[model samples]
Target: MNRLARQSLLLAGLLLPVLPLAAQHVDHAGHGASHARDPMAAAIAAPSRTPANVARDKYRHPAETLAFFGVRPDQTVVEYSPSGGWYTEILAPLLSAKGTFYALQPVGRNLDGYKTFLAAKPDVYGKVKLVPFPDQLSLIPAGSVDTLLTFRNIHNMVMNGTEAATFKSFYDLLKPGGILGVVDHRLPEARDSALEKTSGYLKVSTIRRLAQAAGFEYVGSSEINANPKDTADWEKGVWTLPPTLRNGEVDKARYLAIGESDRMTLKFRKPAS
Candidate 1:
């Protein structure tokens, strides 16, 4: 080969090895660009879901709750008692491609209203699997879930005397190192002995004990939704506030001033063997 031709051939040989690295960098950039352009990003970024949804004011936790539990866009999550699917609407789409979202409820449970809503929005609701548990969580295989989340539902379980069984089922469903995130209306510490089912509040200590009995380690608690203004003394309970307005005008302004109920953000973990 001539001198110029030899030089060009040598340059080509040198460039070949570096090409793969350059291509890898480009691929990574494209992947990042795709994530940036994702529709869920825009939805999560929108102002309507922030602070809390006005239409569904019950959820007002700080962003730290999800962050603390290491909840990513990709993970199998089972949400318990997804009443009205307020958070479900957010989680289902967020985990659409990268993760799975399952709503576990008892079979024969009255889900007519929720089913109708889901039927209307197939695109959004299709992502969720409504797993039915006949009487317990026997329907879910053991060690199959990544996270189990119950928001404002523990009180109901406690009131119904199902807390122990429910938590045990939660423990059974999660894989080792899985997380359980809970947020619920906080009852006064003093009321643990006296508060009845009608109170709409739960003692944090009682909740901790119940979770511990379920084979989960109490990770910690967060002040994400704590409210000092609430005395846990509402006549209509937590529902007397914004969303439910249960009492229907006796102290509308006074209760509205309180916004949503003060809640407790708790994190629990299943130990890794």
Candidate 2:
């Protein structure tokens, strides 16, 4: 081959691998730019999600929150107390194709609503597995789950005095090195500890201590769901904020302007033995 042809061929071969990397970009949040799309985004954007739930996306940050949890479509996951199946609609279908999704709702809690939600759409929820927690945790093989998620429910557990049992169950259900993603209303450390029981907010130290006591290592935390406007000292607790706004029309606009509770997103992992 001519010298010019040989030089051109060499340059083309060197550029092939770099071309793919160059085409990809990383966003400020360190997601979405690299790839043309993310499965979690597609799941969150699915038309199957209710308009009400979709409207809450700005406050919930499902895509960034789940991604922070490192959720994948091909892992065995458990969502504790899926409360009204808000995340269920996204998780069930995401894992439906290649992974296992177990909804660990308590029998007397929101289980009925969860059932009705799943029943309403067989195609989206066909692969979901239901296991009543505390009562039916045994149904999920011990140490087999890849990830366990509990969003905005820890305070309820604390209020009901079930946090220890719940955390122990979380440890037992996860495999060694398995992940635990927790999202709950944030209560500043300066706030009265008594508020956690009735106010629907919790201190991060409280959660960390509880998780570590149950034998899980602190992984990290994310601010994807944080809302600065929330003062965390509402009359009816976190519920006094948007979504719940338990106070009715009294000061509704002010609460609406404040938006959802400021939440702390945390991740923990069972020690890999």
Candidate 3:
């Protein structure tokens, strides 16, 4: 080969290796840039808390219940009667950067305890907002919330004679097409009368009717929190299980095995405009 041609070929061979290296570097950089722009990706990459990591000693189907509600990292969500804020510790951090998290405490109720609890966990719950409700849903602004969630709190309202107003309030707070997710202790169909007002259990059908009456369509139910072993009969009612274990230290082992009460996970949706 001529000297000029040989020189050109040598230069091309040396540049070929550098071209692949430069291409690889650009591809990696692009992938990192894309991930940085994705809020969900970033949240997962540095997850502050997950259901598996939280202390759910009394909550059943923690992960499945949340997933069925279609909770995202980018939506406004309000948790009703967030007693002690167990879920709040995880949720506030999860939605802090990408969404709004509101803890709706009932009005006239002392919240000094809750405020103190939150103050201790600034890193995870820094974005949380405390919204007070005046013992009624009318206090919630119209078309303001994207999602409303209540977990195992319905029975108390029902037994206390506040079920109708509570459901109506839930219906009003949701935006069109928004969701109202409820998880509550379940009462057997035939045992409704005997268990509804006393035990923590409520008939699933009753909940469905209430939701429908409040302008929400019953989407469906889930067995995520069902416990076949729970005969639904306990001396102290649903509180006989762990966390509450209201029986004191007696039969602690047996009750611990029973875990929390059997619950029903129900989803209802407000009509879309």
Candidate 4:
């Protein structure tokens, strides 16, 4: 080979190792940028959300709560019992553009009202797929979900004696590596466990046990939705707090000051195998 050609070849060999390093740097930088761009921001701030729902953001901490569950914008997600579409307002929009969002409403009167809410905003909620869960659990094929979430509804499951079946259904619906994100009113461990059936609050251990029984790995828990002011003992249970105020006008100011119920934010994952 000519001297110039040999020199060129030598130079190419020397730069080859550096090329991968440069590419790796670019990839790492891009990953960081992705995190900087919060996926839940737009959904949380969307104009379609009702003013009342917006007011609840302080207590809900939707973005942090969802992030703790590792929710993404490109996965199949289901929300169990999206009554009144509180999280629905955020979740449906978050998944509409790239992911599939299912509103798993039970077959009941609330389903009709939820339908009305979605119909009113076809543009935002138009892509939502509604399934009458438990009864219609088969509507979603087994092992198809990436994440299944239930917010503030497990107490009813315990009260109705369907908690086991509900957990089984969730386990069946999630993919082998799927996630279950749960947010519910927090019941102090020292408090009477029986209150779970009557109060809206639930013990974190109760959820962990049920989920573990369903074959999910206990991933972790977050305090994002916790409120220290909530004592979890009230005349009307959790509803005595704001939002429901089941004991309206009796201590309205106190309830309003306490705001929403203290909640436990938990994450569990289906075994990858």
List, residue by residue over 45-136, the lDDT tens digit for candidate 4. Answer: 77899998999999999999999998999999999999899999999888887899998998873989999999999998999999986577
Instruction: Report the lDDT tens digits of candidate 2 across residue range 1-273.
Output: 999999999999999998667656433335544332567766887779999999999999898898899899999999999969999989987887789999999879978888898999998887889888778788999999999999999998899999998999999999999999999999999988988888899999999999999999999999999999999988788888889889999999999999999999999999998
What TM-score quantifies how close candidate 3 is to the native fold? 0.78
> How far does residue 153 in candidate 2 sit from its true spot (Å)?
0.6
Give candidate 4's error at residue 9 in angstroms. Answer: 61
- Judged by lDDT against the true structure, how good is candidate 4? 0.90
Give the lDDT of residue 4 in candidate 1.
100
Clashing pairs in 4: none
| Candidate lDDT values, in order | 0.78, 0.90, 0.79, 0.90
TM-score of each: 0.79, 0.86, 0.78, 0.85
| Residue-by-residue lDDT tens digits, candidate 1, 1-273 | 899999999999999999999999999898768757764543354343424453443356424566666677778889888757677767777777788888886555546666775677787678788776545556567898898998888888877787898899899999999999999999888775557477779888988999898889999988878878788888777888767889888888987887788889999999998
Worst 10 residues of 1 by lDDT: 41-50
Q: Which parts of model 3 have CA positions greater than 4 angstroms off?
A: 1-53, 57-59, 108-110, 135-140
RMSD of each: 9.6, 7.9, 6.8, 10.3
Q: Taking the tens digit of each residue's C-alpha lDDT, what string does model 3 give over 143-247?
A: 778888998889888888989987887888889999999988888888747578888888899999999999998888888888877777886888888678898
Model 4 off-target regions past 4 Å? Answer: 1-37
State, as a TM-score between 0 and 1, how close model 1 is to the true structure: 0.79
Which is the better candidate, 1 or 2, if ranked by lDDT? 2
